[model samples]
Target: MSLFEGLSAFPITPADPSGRVDTVALARVLNRLADARVDSIGLLGSTGAYAFLTREERRRAVEAAMATVGGRIPVIVGVGALRTDDAQALARDARAAGANGLLLAPVSYTPLRDEEVYAHFAAVAESGELPLAIYNNPGTTRFTFSRELIGRLSEVANIAAVKMPLPADGDFAGELDAIRSVTSPSFRIGYSGDWDCAASLLAGGDAWYSVAAGLLPVETLALARAAQSGDVAQTQRLNAAFEPLWSLFREFGSFRVVYVIAELLGLCKVEPLRPVLPLPDTARDRVAAALIVLRKHFA
Candidate 1:
């Protein structure tokens, strides 16, 4: 299987109240994910709060994750920055730090054109030899990818996989089919925005870039395994069980909900980075209740 072709854990960067990336907390989270037997760990993905931290903090987080992983599994570090040069620099650093792969998003305050976006990944691909995954998260970056553009990008030599967010239109089964028709077979497909993972995977997509995997890897991996095994009946049953958590993701965003679940589970002291508050107590109570059902019946 491709390195990211299974459940790759995306953890929130655990920082202290002072906003410093707490290496100890990060190590604990990494080891937990490793023990869960994730195929890989993606550090500094948006879930990891890469945008909120300084470049130095990101480097430190990646370093900590690499040390903690100890080559037991592949580590893909995000090299996304608003500026192309900065992104290239981060990619170089990732290569130097011995990361096995790179993940980047078209993070921009201003809108980016097709050529500019292509250039961003191409420049970084030239900077280092590690494999790269293009992350297309329109909700967070306000940048979207047309299938045509993604096809063109897959031509870049080192670009390996694409991490896609399921569309708001809620037809990801169709979306995966559409994406596959445009991109080549060599360019693997992975979905993020975890709610629709079962549908995407059953539609023959390659992998899931999972938020829940870091916090609830065993539960999430069970669903992924069902999808991979072509057990449609089991996959649907598992998907039905997760609809409650999916509802919470739609209502209050996965970033908040997952951290609350992690905190309640005693996984880590997870709080969103600055400018975002913790989920309200009522929301947490709802998530706690859903998790109870999940653990008792589904998980």
Candidate 2:
């Protein structure tokens, strides 16, 4: 399968007020996304609060999402950790739990050479036994995979795709050309931090890993379909309808804004995770207002 061919929302792992996994809330979110016809559900991703979750919590989240989804769509589990062994263990657990694929990021707390990153991915690919998508979120890992490293990892067995978060000011075409140059013909390139879905699509992005889609899946899926069909007018219209929501990412963090919007849309019950802090009360009100406007426009 292609790396990220369809709509995938990174659902926040529901936590109770006491900070425990809230499976009931998680099930509700998954069912909502499935009802909206999202192609896949990504658990334990950056938005899912993976770093705060223990290994058991991660496993439980995967199981809960899989059970809730029940083969309706694929589940791509995020298996990122500060240690390679921990990440590998999570990958194995996710596979055993029946996840469709794995999203593996480089280990944090370590400055890895390009060769070391390749070797780490090589080991995880061997152990996971599932198709792997190399996650290149430099903001979190403090390391970005060079094109050379991507080329090496792409050659590894089971390494099927890449998730690249391009620098904001970087030359996207140049970066795309460099990645395309080294990756195999079958390797899919996913734009991880794409807020402007239409612009990214027009700029040659194959697919996007979207957080806004988590709140507005119907609109998000419509935009994705329009992009795939090369309907520029429709794509532009959809993007314009949701442009306010997309613009929030610039003023505030994406995950924080997404969580607030989720609660506003009644998709999730909890607030944003700690350390990240909840959106200001005024911001929450603005997001709610924007979402209401979007619902009407998209309707």
Per-candidate TM-scores read: 0.94, 0.94
- The best candidate in terms of lDDT: 1
109-211 in candidate 2: lDDT tens per residue? 7588887777788888888999888889888888888888888898999888887885567566677778989988888777766455555566676667777
Model 1: lDDT equals 0.85
Residue runs of model 2 more than 4 Å from their true location after superposition: 1-3, 167-173
Total clashes in model 2, counting residue pairs 3 or more apart in sequence or in different chains: 0
The TM-score leader among the candidates is: 1
